[model samples]
Structure formats: C-alpha cells, structure tokens
Target chain A: GQQVQQSPASLVLQEGENAELQCNFSSTATRLQWFYQRPGGSLVSLLSNPSGTKHTGRLTSTTVTKERRGSLHISSSQITDSGTYLCAMSNNNAPRFGAGTKLSVKP
Target chain B: ETAVFQTPNYHVTQVGNEVSFNCKQTLGHDTMYWYKQDSKKLLKIMFSYNNKQLIVNETVPRRFSPQSSDKAHLNLRIKSVEPEDSAVYLCASSPDWGSQNTLYFGAGTRLSVL
Candidate 1:
C-alpha cells in the first residue's frame, strides 16, 4: 500500500488557468511539503504546510492533518510552471513521497 | 540558490562494478537524506542521517551503504551495482531532523548500469 497518494496523475491546461493538485496520506503525517521538479532537474520546495493553509505568490497550499490530505492550488498558470508536482509527508522520522502530478501548461 | 550539491551528474558502469556518489549541503543543516527515483519516476527514501548519525535505513540491498563524515556531507556507495540499480540518486538536506522541517534537494546523479 502506498503511504502517500496523489490525484490526477497528469494534467494539461492552458496558460492562465487554475490548477488544483491533491495529496492523501494513509497514516498520520506530522509535516507536509510540496515540491516542483522540471524535466531533468532537481526538486525545488514550493511550500511547507504542516496543518494550515499557506500561500506564496501564485501558489496556495492547504493541509488538513486530521484528514490526512493536502492540496496545492496554482492560480494563473504559466508555461514555466509546467512540471511535476510532488507532495511529501513526514510520519515520525521517515519521509514518504507521492507518485506526483505531472502538469503541463500550454501557452 | 543551490544549497545542496551532488557530484558526477551522470555515471554509466557495468554490473558488479563499484560506484560512489557524493553530496554536500551548505545550508548548515543537521539532517541529510538519500533518495532513489526509478524509471517510473517513483521516488523513495533510502537513508537518512541526523548530525552524521544514521536515523533511518530503508530495506535497501546490503551492497548499498551511506556514509556521513559530518552534518554537511553524506555519501552513497554501491559495492556491486546491478541493472536494477540504474536510477537517479537524489540528495536532500533539512535544517533539523523533525517532521516539521522542509527538505532541499540537489540535482540528482543519474546512474546507468550495463
């Protein structure tokens, strides 16, 4: 069983559209973080939300620990934002990662 | 803006050969980790160290080992590589070893085993 699960394995959208990504954990998560990875590039941290909603620029993340789920909302998407979005959770001292949502934004 | 650094952006070797990858963090973090991403792009944690002490070791093969000389450096070594070992090895670091901390990752080292 996967400890972390992400919805919409892949998404394609036009520029300026809004995109929503979901993450669900099978167990209790003490921390949650969202990351973005361009093709053949390193993972970049987007947001770290433990339990509440946090915002940064065009990205907004909301995590509800009690439900073991988190979401990343991207507003006004751009072609540069086209990449894989991964959500990771921490349970105890171990880290669990989701399969990730591959998003493509067309200009 | 790159805090985590990894050596040998790419490596291709034959099976049964030894391979090593290096990782360093300049963020003054106390916790570092090594993750493996397979061809399917599935990422999984292999080892984690906090202040040069092993904290987590996943069910990896015996040939795989992680070495950390200090809090800033953590290295991965495979005694005898296999075809299944071909994957992107990523290195990460966090300021502390807690559930609430965020991890910074390095440009992964792509390994290809023949």
Candidate 2:
C-alpha cells in the first residue's frame, strides 16, 4: 500500500546536464516534500511544494494536487548533486515516502 | 547550523540488547518525528509527537516506543534489538502539524545488530 511512487529508480547524467524526477501519489496530498539523501547520510528537505510550482537555486518542484502527482527538476546538475532524491507526501499528519530516485552526476 | 541533533552517529549491539536513541531540535518546532531508512533505501515514518503528546504511531513493533519530555526533544527506545532493526534512524521536526511547514531532519543514527 505505497501511497507515493517515484519513477526511474536510478538516474545518471553528465555534469551540467539537467534531470527530471517524478513523484506520483495514490490520493490527494495536502503537503508534498522533496528530499535529498547522500550516501550513508540523512535526508535534507529540498522543496515543500504542495501545489503549483516552486523554485530554489537550480531545483524546481511542481505539484498537481488534483492529479496527485509531483515533479522535481534539477537544472545544471553538478557532480556534488549526486545523491538519492526522495519524494514524500502527506494527506494528514504522517508523511509517506516513495522508493526514491538515485541520481549520479558524472564529471 | 545543526538544528536537529542525534547522538551516537553509529551504534553496534548484539541481539536482545536494549538500545535508545536521542533526538533534540532547536528550531522550536511543535512536532517531532522518527523515521527509519532501511538498507534498500526505503524511508518510513515510525512515530510523531507534537507538544510532547503522541500524535501519529505507525504500525511499528511494540518493542519500539517514543518518549518525549518536551516539544523540543523526542527519544526512541527499543526494548530488544533484532537483526531487522539494523538501519538508519532519522529524526525530523516541523514548525507544526500544519501543511505549511516543511520537515527538517537530523543526520541520523546508524544501528547495527548482530
């Protein structure tokens, strides 16, 4: 009963390239959050876009609440940006997570 | 710059042993949570507390319990360690239970059970 699903379990790209990650949920989400997890590290919140679109630095997050879907775009990817991107959504109090998309940026 | 603090970056113990992990947040958040990340990279919420009151308790084992003395601190205690319990435990907090706030996470404590 996974509520959140992320596509392309893993991704690889050259430096300076752009990457697009998708997140789909089974039900309406009142809150959507994107997180980044480095190897053997913790998760850092990247974006918290429940609806519409939002941007921060080279990252962009768009969520369609009605459609129960969200997307995270990473522009000009760098080697340091290599990590696992996780998408979480909450309809109420507790948040649910997807398997995540692991991104590797090669220089 | 460390808003959320988790002690014992790594811990190793034998099966049947008891373990406790501590978490504290300085962001003055009203809600705190405990999440577990398995080796397969699956993150799941275990429990959540708001204002020192238990809010959300997922279908975790009864051996796992969340203890909170205040809104700023949330601790996790396991009565008996098991091999399946070896994973990274993350602590997170948000300003409140409202949808307007984003969660801030700690570095996590990696546990290894033999």
Give the range of the ten consecutive residues with the poorest summed lDDT in model 2 chain A. Answer: A88-97
Show where candidate 2 strays beyond 4 Å.
none
Looking at model 1 chain A, which ten-residue stretch has the lowest summed lDDT? A90-99
What fnat does each of the candidate structures reach?
0.77, 0.74
Chain B vs. true chain B: TM-score for each candidate?
0.99, 0.98
Model 2 lDDT per residue over A1-107, tens place: 54889998999999999999999999889989999999988888899977999999999999999999999999999999999999999876678899999999999
- lDDT (Cα, tens digit) per residue for candidate 2, span B1-114: 689999889999999999999999999999999999999899899999989999899999999999999999999999999999999999999999867658899999999999
TM-score (C-alpha, index-matched) for candidate 1: 0.98
lDDT of 1 at A53: 97
- List model 1 lDDT by residue over A7-79, tens digit each: 8899999999999999999988888899999989999999997899999999999999999999999999999
- Any runs in candidate 1 off by more than 4 Å, and if so which? none
**TM-score of model 1's chain A:** 0.96
DockQ value for model 2: 0.79
lDDT of 1 by residue, B1-114 (tens): 999999989999999999999999999999999999997778999999999999999999999999999999999999999999999999999988887669999999999999
